[model samples]
Target: MAQGSSSPGDDAGNLDKTFREWQDDGSSEVATLGGVYGGANGVNHMVLNVRDMEKSHDFWTRVMRLEHCGTQGGPGQPRFLRFYRSHGHTHHDIALSPAKDPDSLPIPTGPLQTPGLNHFAWTYPDLETWKQQVRHVVDTGYPIQFRMEHGMSQSLYVRDPDGTVVEMMYEFPEERWNENIEAALEYRRVLDIDNDPDYFDPKPEDMPLFDENGLAEAS
Candidate 1:
């Protein structure tokens, strides 16, 4: 499509090295920072339309290290549904439901480029927990498709059984990015994750923030 108008899940493979800025399409509309109205509280859960519930259950638990709460319907039942949770927050963070017609769709072989759910991220409650999940993914030979140092947070992106992008990330202390969230959003550093021996550790120094004019400055 057009530069700066691409979705985050665009099929383009070289975004890691690309420097991007929002391109206005001549629309002057804007939304309130938080919201003029309260809006929905937050994304409580997501139910994915998956081809195989068992396979999806395996991958979701593998990447998220979530608790497989339970399953619903089976045997004489007409559908299969499974639920998973990360505790601390709510009863379930993700669930799986059978797709409308498994054979009608061509299974995606790469990152999703189509119009749909872009991606959903789950920020681990603690750093070690997040690293543990990353290590497990590497150890088990699950493909770690993308890695990014996003200033305030570092993330690893992996595809699930249905080729949906799921990001596992952990944020640094709020002090690191609260000062210049605008700069934080602009920061993008793609690192050689597996090659770097200490990739799981917090960056030695705080990430650089910038002034309103985009000049590098302290956090």
Candidate 2:
């Protein structure tokens, strides 16, 4: 009959045509049958609770060098501070809210060897930019915990005013990621104080006199 069309006895031909059309649609109906939601497409934003809204805002904007969106609050009410990276156009990357008792959250006293939120990592374009941030952290006297090679990424960890750990990282090439992640996990598992030794112990020399941009003089 017509090219690629089904005839009365051509059931196999019709099935092949139907299967091809399904494949062309790009989404797999059969694969989605398990009801699994896909991974996140990207990071939208994150919110954090802090004790002093003003202090937290200053730390993020002045020290961390994030762009301050604004502050919102009324008399006798808790305040909220919104911030985003200079390159970000969305609402905000982070929001800080005032909590009643800030000190209640237990600060991580020892090295990060256990399972939990280790830190939130942000990527940098290159090593130079990362080192500039390192210099800023050193100058500002921010409590830097460690500088580490995670195989997939090189990272620096620091604690914010509210005791939240933040990470700055430069991701390695895509092909190396899986091996790096595996290596990082193994490193964490086998880490020992006497064996590997700690690289980042906060000291007076490690503290920076300026903020991240190396502009503002720390007080």
**Which has the greatest TM-score?**
1
- Please give, for residues 196-215, the per-residue lDDT of candidate 2 as tens digits: 43222322222223222332
lDDT of 1 by residue, 1-219 (tens): 123213434424423222221123343343222222122357788989888777887887765678888788863368767889988567888888888788887777665688878788989777788788777887878888877778677788888888888888888777666667887888877768758655666543544555555526544
Candidate 1 segments whose C-alpha is farther than 4 A from its true place: 1-37, 210-219
TM-score of each: 0.74, 0.60
**lDDT at 143 for candidate 2?**
71
Stretches of candidate 2 exceeding 4 Å from the true structure: 1-39, 103-106, 111-116, 178-181, 184-219
Give the lDDT of residue 76 in candidate 2: 51
Which lDDT value does model 2 have at 144? 76
Q: How accurate is candidate 1 locally (lDDT)?
A: 0.69
Query: Local error of candidate 1 at 131, Å?
Result: 1.6
- Name the candidate that leads on lDDT: 1
- Among all windows of 10 consecutive residues in model 1, the one with the lowest summed lDDT is 30-39
